[model samples]
Target chain A: NAGVTQTPKFRILKIGQSMTLQCTQDMNHNYMYWYRQDPGMGLKLIYYSVGAGITDKGEVPNGYNVSRSTTEDFPLRLELAAPSQTSVYFCASSWGMNTEAFFGQGTRLTVV
Target chain B: GIQVEQSPPDLILQEGANSTLRCNFSDSVNNLQWFHQNPWGQLINLFYIPSGTKQNGRLSATTVATERYSLLYISSSQTTDSGVYFCAVEMAGSGGSNYKLTFGKGTLLTVNP
Candidate 1:
């Protein structure tokens, strides 16, 4: 099963450009999350959704936005991408609270 | 907000050697997990031990919720085990049900032949 899938395994964005990192899960999980990992640092939460239409900001939410329109899709949007926004983005999903989370392969983004 | 810290920021071991990685949280948590990120940047879940201990083959994990700490043990390490190990936790009372995971910097492990 394709637990969690992220599109555009790698991308290069110009300054001020906007792009959406697509994420979809086939496990029918209720909770979805977006996180980014910088060089030599742990993954930091960007946004999370408990369910469809319910989204919340996480620890590092600036320059990023997320929308959960359905149970399987949670896409992250990066507006006005800047050099500081360059990082590896990961999408994760869990069955519910306190459950094991599954992560995607990750999208390596480079903002120039 | 909850704080998670992982010990031994870096470790190197010869094949067949064993090692233990520790994770400490600042407060109580409802969920605790360990993940290994391969060099290719893929995060693989190793365990979901919120409490007690669980063993899976050569890898095992123990979580002491009351003490706000967790330990991940790897036995007979291999070169493929070289990666960044991360500890993540979801605070118990952060948002009633909208729990978000907070991660520690991570422990980099390198296994040599």
Candidate 2:
């Protein structure tokens, strides 16, 4: 089974452009999260969902929005793309919140 | 939010050498995990040790939950082991609603073969 899958492995967005980073999992996990990692820095949470229809803000959620419409998909939306938002985005999921989270290969987004 | 700290922000080692990585947390947690991020940027879960020790191949990990510290040991390092290692922890309760990961800056290891 594909644990965590993320699409658009790479992308470049112009200023003010908007796009969505797609993530899906077949693990039947209740917890899904979005994180971004920059060079020389650790990953920071952007948003998380405990389950379908339950979403919450995370450490860095200013330029992004998320929705959990189904158990398999948790997509992150970036509105008004800014260079500051450029980084490697990862999607993860776990059976529970306080457990090991399986991560996606990551999406490298460059905003110019 | 809990605070997690990892020691030796950067490390360089020769092939066949050994290394030790440490992680310290500020609060109590029933869950703590170690992950290795390869050059391809995929995070590989190493272990989920809340206490005692676990060994997998040349890699082993130890966690002293009572003391709020954990250790990871790498033996006979190789160039493929050159990557970032992270330690994360989460508090458990109320069906783990307190579940949010706090990650350390990570230890960047460069193993020269």
Candidate 3:
């Protein structure tokens, strides 16, 4: 079974362009998160959802938006891409609080 | 939010050698995890030891919640083990609403043959 699946494994966007990073999980997890990892920097949380229709901002939520209309999907939207936003984005999910998280392969996005 | 720190920042070991990685947190936490990001940039879950100890083959991990620290032990290191090790934690929050994980800068490891 595919634990966590992320689409657009790689992408390039010009400044001010917009795109969405799609994430899906087959494991009926209740908690889903979006994180971005930059060079020499640790993964920074962007947004997370406790469950369907329940979303919350994380450490870095600017320039991004998320929606969880269904338990199986949590998509991250980039309204205005910037060079600073060019980083590897990862999608993760867990059964619930205090559980091990499963991460997707990650999407490599480069904004010019 | 909790603060996570990992050391010794960098490590180099020869094949068949053993090494230990450490992670320290600034506050109490309800969840802690260790991850290995390979050169290919794929993150692989190493351990999910919030408390006590867990072992898997050549790797093991221990978490002392009361001390706000954890240790990861790798035995008989191999070239495949070269990667960046990261420690992440989720602070203990009321009603479990605050579940965001804070990660350390990470410890870069290189295993030479």
Which portions of model 3 miss their true places by more than 4 Å?
Answer: B95-97
Give the better candidate number (2 or 3) by TM-score.
3
Worst 10 residues of 3 chain B by lDDT: B93-102
B-chain TM-score, candidate 2: 0.95
lDDT, model 2, position A28: 95
Give per-residue CA lDDT, model 2, range A10-67, as digits (tens): 9999999999999999999999999999988878899999999999888889989999
Worst 10 residues of 1 chain B by lDDT: B91-100
* Reference-based TM-score, model 3: 0.97
Q: Write the per-residue lDDT of candidate 3 for residues A12-74, one digit (tens) a residue.
A: 999999999999999999999999999988999999999999999888999999999999999
Model 2 bad stretches (over 4 Å) = B94-97
Per-residue lDDT for B1-113 in model 1, tens only? 67899999999999999999999999888899999999888999999999999999999999999999999999999999999999999878646433777899999999999
Clash list (residue pairs), candidate 3:
none
Q: Scoring model 3 with DockQ, what do you get?
A: 0.72
Docking category for candidate 1?
medium
